[model samples]
Target: MNAEPRPQESLSGKEISPTDPARFPRLGFLLGLVVVYWALYFVVGAIDKPYFYGFIYGLASALLFAICFFTWWWGNRAIRRSEKILGFVLIVGVGVLVGKFSDRTVNFFPLCTLGLPLVATLVLGWLALVKRSLISSHWLGFAAAVALGFGVFDLIRMDGFDSSLKTHLSWRWTPTAEQRFLAENAASAAAVKPSVAKTVPLHADASTWTAFRGPNRDGVAHGTNVPTDWNSNPPQQLWKRAVGPAWSSVIVIGDRVYTQEQRGPVESVVCYDAATGQQVWAHDDETRFDEAVSGAGPRATPTFAEGRIYAFGGTGILNCLDAETGKVVWSRDTKNDSQGKPPMWGLASSPLVTDKNVIVYGGGEANKSLLAYHQDTGNLAWTAPAGQQSYSSPEIVTIAGVRQCLMFHDFGLTSVDPATGRKLWESGAVMKGAPRTGQPHLVDGNKLAVAVLDGPGVSLVSVTKEGDQWKVAPVWASKDLKPEFPDFVVHDGSAYGFDSSIFCCLNLATGKRSWKDGRFGRGQVILLADQGLLLVVSESGEAILQAADAQARKELGRFQALNGKTWNSPVVANGRLYLRNAEEMACYDLTPRRQASIR
Candidate 1:
């Protein structure tokens, strides 16, 4: 037993006694940490605040590198100090190089940060611990395993994300939805004679959606009483058609619908036939604005006023065009008019047309914050100070018997005269420097409810006028009912909106949550006030029907309406439901006469 031992030979028939010591001391510990890390990841994604999501993700990433180095250290039982240092440089160096230089989307950033590295560790363990004699050097085997891991990741690309922050990934070389649509449109056009786009006749319908949310810019669908009994009377799809990338919602005016989208190098204000889903007229500009998460498109929903279309582009270009001809009557670059740079998302003011002026958010330096232009002439009417930027549009609301134009931005709630850009009142302390998105909801008669971005949730405040000064003060704030990009509506003394991506109801008077259920993603909703029902559009393009009750969440029925991510709000007029996302537009009959048919 005391005799000098000879060199050990591995299964590869090479001397490996010095390097391969037949030990994986770090293996058991590595497996245990993985379980703990995943448990924390899911919990953080579910209940944690929006800002703290990165902290846990970053801490776990550091542990992955620790696993790599420790596996190399403990796998070698008899290596010298120089060999140990050299192994460190090799394993850690290549990892830093690959992780930093790889092309990827933020869609899968949090998930793949730990997932791919763990896969590599599994491969290393299989060869080093399970099949211990196969490798001559632990360092070489570890390098091979890491390379295979990156190779697998390199072939995968992220498309986008759902509301729950999960990635939608696909093979790298796969054709995108936009590419397929473009190809199909080109092929169809080539089959016929290339002719100029014709002007379509326009008329105001009996029941119309002439603005972003409605005539009042509130998410209330009037006149149509949608039957909630889907088994007995289900919604039927009338038509569906492919559309370009855009966050813009459709504004229905009688037989034609108006919206904006980005097609390749052009940003188009298009009019489509509501009955047939066919292109009636399209006006294109030589400009395109695109972002990774929101994709490429115009951001603001076009408004129809005085038989003219008022459309604001994502890149700050605002155009007023003839309703029937799609001809630009007047155009102005709002970025230049306001003297302010575009925000990270871009200019998203849905032009507010008044009796004398058309108001839009300027967000510029100095005192040029809000800009109003003459309706007929493109002359600048007035400019006033506002928040630096906002994705919310200008809304006209009457508070305390006075008509005021309301704008929600980083500076919280602001009110100005629609004809002249004069700041009337503002509540800025609660919402400073946070990206304001949720539309300011007028609660009761004098109170207002809004989404506070970093303030974490919903805030209700009372607005009253004492003499010449206007007073706005907070009533109650609830972290349980936060809604950012999606707006909320007040119904039967309660507010109905998304708490994060899940549907929730909160008491307007107390700011206390009543009930929250159904994970509908970060989609949109419309209150069918005529029938006391809520029509919800899920992010995955499903139409859900539920009663507007504060006691409990009662889901009446649901059906798939579109495909892919749907963040755009739904429009209901008469007995028809009109909805769309960046990729497509659709119409459905929600009346009892249509006994559930989908195209």
Candidate 2:
């Protein structure tokens, strides 16, 4: 009939055939579906609801796997069923093994969650191409191509990608500059002479930051003339020093700067000269707390009051130390008193010093959820029942003429009398089991602006007293601005802070967004009320100064303040700007006159 079939013209060549023309259109449709599904998945995942984010991403990844498997089946029909099944099993099994044990810097969970299916598709395509010699294996190749393409696309779209992505991409990579600085500083800290307490005088009245988030636990910087224009005259870098891993902000009292950090395996409460950045004195305890995302070190900023520093460690250790000497006056293990384990993030609540007691969130579901210890001696003053734990620090605010400490617990917000630890008013329905990390901003005398990691963005709550009972109810809830960790400040009848790392402002009365702009990552902000400016320390390590106008965002000036992740809040004491993270600490002179002594 036809010429005798050549050895080269075998059944494999004719039967296998090129990727069918009819199948090409279907393949294109499936590829488009994969792209569209993931695009919407990413958009939904970034909406700030943790549970919804988990669900959408999980569903999207699963669907992607199914679609890829379908392509494999359509393309590898020539391969034996056993061979195809065996290849799939072998590829997925090896992928799971390697993905689980791989260096986590690249994000271990995501690699496995997104990589296993990709490897399966790739290996299946390889088998069809090289082993079975199926011409239609090109369809499987398309599936593998889609997997590889989206894996990178997803990584780039992650939150905090610009600043934190490098930390994830590199394998066992180290910041050589930061490491050298820490090493040198550690050597210097060790060789430093004894503290000359009598030589340096302490000015108690000169304290600028006596507690966390400034005086009143509000993110307001008073009497500060923050430079509006940094173009011609930039802020001076007065002092730069290396610090250990910690998210604790520096509290400046008198001539010393107090903060807690992890010094290797020890949790250290340190004091440095505010003006010179010299290590004054440091006290170390044999304790350490570690986490993957938050990293190692203390979370709560040290509280300075009554010539003593009340320091709380991430491991639940509370110490009352001498402000000048860094010597432990008294210490208490809060976890023991509460009979509860440390929180997932750690005991991040800073010690709240009142006129009579030092209040801290113990998070113990028993009667010891909120514990108040005597300020001077670490003796138990009072213990009260709070629902569960909260990472937010306790704050003393006067609501409806009643001075109570507000504790945003895991269950909801609870206000208790500081002296007796008596629950004055509790708002359990304000937020559910979602984490309440943001501080409740007092909108006025009776209303509070509260935000959480889940639910509606922010809610305005009104506290009013009808006879002996105090009732707290939501006035309005808006899905405009949701804060993750950084606190927002209310100014000119509006609240300003990061709405999932995007700087935004919301009208307090209506709970509606006035305007949302700027992408500052999940960094902290300080309200320069005196100057009508918003000083934002971006998570990308830049200090940006913007106007507090609700009409529109106007970025006046910006400067690179740090080189790494900066979640630590910026402190403006007198005219100096102090900023630090887990790795380093820096001080900048914000006022026109440079080198003003931080005395």
Model 2 regions lying over 4 Å from their true place:
1-85, 92-101, 104-108, 124-167, 173-182, 190-207, 428-432, 595-599
Candidate 1 lowest-lDDT run of ten? 48-57
Clashes in model 2: which pairs?
none
Tens digits of per-residue lDDT for model 2 on 102-188?
444335445544555545444434433443444533434534544453344233311112222222233233443335656887688
The total number of steric clashes, by the backbone 3 Å criterion, in model 1 comes to 0
In terms of TM-score, how similar is model 1 to the real structure?
0.86
- Please, what are the lDDT tens digits per residue for candidate 1 over residues 269-356? 9988776677768888899886554577888899988789999888888899998779989999888878887776667788888857
Q: What lDDT is obtained when candidate 1 is compared to the true structure?
A: 0.76
Model 1 off-target regions past 4 Å?
A: 1-35, 42-127, 191-206, 362-367, 430-433, 592-599
RMSD of 2: 5.4
User: Root-mean-square deviation of each candidate, in angstroms?
Assistant: 4.3, 5.4
Please tell me which predicted candidate would have the highest lDDT against the true structure: 1
Query: Would you list the C-alpha lDDT of every candidate in the order shown?
Result: 0.76, 0.73
